[model samples]
Target chain A: MTDRPLDPAVLTPDQARALFRAGLSVPTAGWCAGRTQANLIAVPREHAYDFLLFAQRNPKPCPVLDVTEPGAVSTRVFAGDLRTDLPAYVVYEHGEPVAEVADATEYWRDDLVAFLIGCSFTFENALLGAGVPVRHIEQGRNVPMYRTSRPCRRAGAIGGPLVVSMRPIPAEQVADAVRVTARYPSVHGAPVHVGDPSELGIADLDAPDFGDPVDVRLGEVPVFWACGVTPQAAVMASRPKFAIGHAPGHMAITDARDCDYIVP
Target chain B: MTDRPLDPAVLTPDQARALFRAGLSVPTAGWCAGRTQANLIAVPREHAYDFLLFAQRNPKPCPVLDVTEPGAVSTRVFAGDLRTDLPAYVVYEHGEPVAEVADATEYWRDDLVAFLIGCSFTFENALLGAGVPVRHIEQGRNVPMYRTSRPCRRAGAIGGPLVVSMRPIPAEQVADAVRVTARYPSVHGAPVHVGDPSELGIADLDAPDFGDPVDVRLGEVPVFWACGVTPQAAVMASRPKFAIGHAPGHMAITDARDCDYIVP
Candidate 1:
């Protein structure tokens, strides 16, 4: 397939699923523009309880979109073939990445369950639509994400520190930025912290645990929202026997729009 | 124990826990006036994922307040002893109610985990404060709840219909009612359906599945909000080996106030 900019409007859910299945589309971040893109995770049935509890305990970071039946792929909320829908899959064994593959259909097991977690892209779109500038998007860089000292309450087997993504916003538009993003609670909701990075135990703004760091110019306050990487961190810390997640930027684009997930 | 009207203002968290421990307060709805209360559910660790997914799928009805660590009694958000915090609890054995106990400490196993779900009382207080009269409260009866034809998306072993509570509000106050309740997303968020009972599959407003029927006076529309009974219905349908929940009207009073859960 050629490296052409995909138009989300013309693409059907089946077509999107097919492209993902064939590895034609890579990262789903900007592919389906207005649609709700979800973070993916597959874990053994035994750890489902702890993982779900962890998500519940830290909702802002892990806003669960839908959880599939044990060993089942079809999700009612997303309505897609999880086995072949996503473009890329990262298989983790004992909390370490073992391989990156095009599909998990080959590794399908009866004891594995899939979880679709709300991604920040949904809220980012809302911010952009409301005329609030997202620094990472403008700079053509990945959003800077940091692991904070904030500890997430532990469940049976899952627990870790909260991870947050920073977006530099002008001081004057801070309240507006909050109000716009607050409407989409299903996707990491409002700002978790505003102003200082040092307050969250970060020694430097230039270095992030994941993603690229952007410049924080004059009159800009670094606003932080809970990042989707939190569940991955929890999964790593828990070190389950088996786990699978989407590659860093690769996401599953669902039929539902960003507007559908907004509470208002 | 004497049946004395409990003063909500003067009751400390310890006093409330003690009263509940001694079975002096059977129903906690009106016991503590100014305090926030939570709906309780205790399930074996194995079913935690299903229960958490059930809450996520049915957020309007099962807004989660806090989830406890497996085998642990305290919730970080609520801050209390779960065993003695609630007035009464009903233990279910494979979907059948077997006992109503004052404290769950005896039956508490290391494999049992607890969840504190948001209750509508918080939003009801906000509505009443805004001059929107709550009919059931005025008539001295439990709020009317009904099981709709709407089916909740299945998650693991949990699946059931969406249950909602109805409140009759003057036509002019519908918007105000929505605006006030929308701020409290932790407690059922906004009205799921406004103005019509038939739209929600209720043929007669005079009869309800649970709680007492309220008078729908002239010029008043029956507005419905998802109720906390949804998880109980799901639990009954799934028939897990062991399940525990607070008896209707009996709730766990928390250290957090109603205002604490509200979004600005």
Candidate 2:
């Protein structure tokens, strides 16, 4: 079957989800322009409480937008089927990636609880709107994410180092970026660290634990925000028997708007 | 044993908790002046996920501060023992109030999960600091709280109408009150309804579902904020088999400062 001619940036959230449901696989960065995109994670019921508590304790890295009831597929924010609508899925077993599949239906469980976490994409758009340059997007690369020395508060069996994503902001625009992004607390909020990466024990900016690296110009400063990968890091460390996540850069387009999460 | 002479308003949080733990029972409104006071709710592990989901869905009425592990009695926010640290406790049997006691150690269960929710006491101080008169405090009465017509989003078995606490603010200072309180989102940030009582389906201004009613003067407008009583209302409506909460007005004093919750 041939894919439809579509401009992801102009498509409505429902249209994007429909396209994804029809098996068109693509990263969701520019999709459904004004809507919020979410990172997905599904874990068995036995581990749901721990994961929820972990997210509660480490809210910066896990700003949960919505959590589906055990075994349920849809939520108020995401009207599409959880098992098949996302462009890509990563299935984990005992903390290790066992498969990357286009459809998660066969891996889905009756007792699974899904969490839709806020992504930095929302804040990046806000940053750009506020005239703050986003290095990764400008370079046409992924944001660089690093595992930090600081450990998140542990909840039950879930515990791991905090992870952060970095962006090089022009010296004068640093404050503007912070003010703009701080408005979206659900989407990682303000920068976790500014100026130095060593403070977070991130020794090298060029070698990120995940995502691609970007150049930091002489007049720019590297600012870091809490990354959504922290929860996945905890899942890896704690080794839950089963877990499912959207592949990096592939997000669940939700019905909620970017402005829905903005604080006054 | 003779009670020690102390000004409740001047005591530190640790001191306040010690006083309560030593069997002194009093409302915590004036205690721990700069620190945050939290509402307590403990339920069986079987019902924890639903309660957490409920809090997540209805953040305005149920701003969660900290949640303890099942069977645990302490958190980073509240270092004191949960079962005995509060000034008063109310035990619930099938959502009906079964007992109100000074100490809850006798009824505490090993499988209970405790949730510490943000209370309006924090924002009330901010309002007073912002030159907004809180009539209930001046009259030495409990802040009036009402059950509203609006229903909170349901999560699993936990769902109920939104509950709001009213304060009479002079029309001129309404904006100031909103700006000051909005800074503290964890404590039910900003007013949910302003001006008309009929809008919220609150039939009488003098009668409230909880707390004592305060007089709304001619130039003063009634401003309603999402109340901490909401989760308890849900508990009563859902009728869980067993639950425990701090008796109304009595609270668990936590280590976090009220300023720690304020946003830019």
What is the Å distance of residue A257 in model 1 from its true position?
1.2
Which candidate should be chosen as best, given DockQ against the real structure? Answer: 2
lDDT (Cα, tens digit) per residue for candidate 2, span A1-264: 236446677898888888878887766666777899998989998999889889999888999999998899999899999999998888999999999888899999999999999988887777877888888777867678899999999988889899898999999999898888888887888999998999999999999987789999999999999988788788788899999998767788999999988876
Model 2 over residues B1-264: C-alpha lDDT tens digits? 227446677888888888888888876775778899998999999999899989999988888899998899998899999988898998999999899988899999999999999998897777778788978878877788899999999988888899898999999999999898888887899899998998999999899988788899999999999988888888888999999998877889999999988875
> How many clashing pairs per prediction, in order?
0, 0
User: In order, what lDDT does every prediction score?
Assistant: 0.80, 0.87
Best by lDDT: 2
**Listing candidates in order, what is each one's chain A TM-score?**
0.90, 0.93
Off by over 4 Å in 2: A1-7, B1-7
Report the poorest 10 consecutive residues by lDDT, candidate 1 chain B: B1-10
**Model 1 Cα lDDT, one tens digit per residue, B168-251:** 999999999999998888889898899778888888888988778889999999999888878877787779999888876677
| Model number with the top TM-score | 2
Q: Model 1 chain A: which ten-residue window has the lowest total lDDT?
A: A1-10
Question: Fnat of the models, one by one?
Answer: 0.53, 0.37
> What TM-score quantifies how close candidate 1 is to the native fold?
0.90
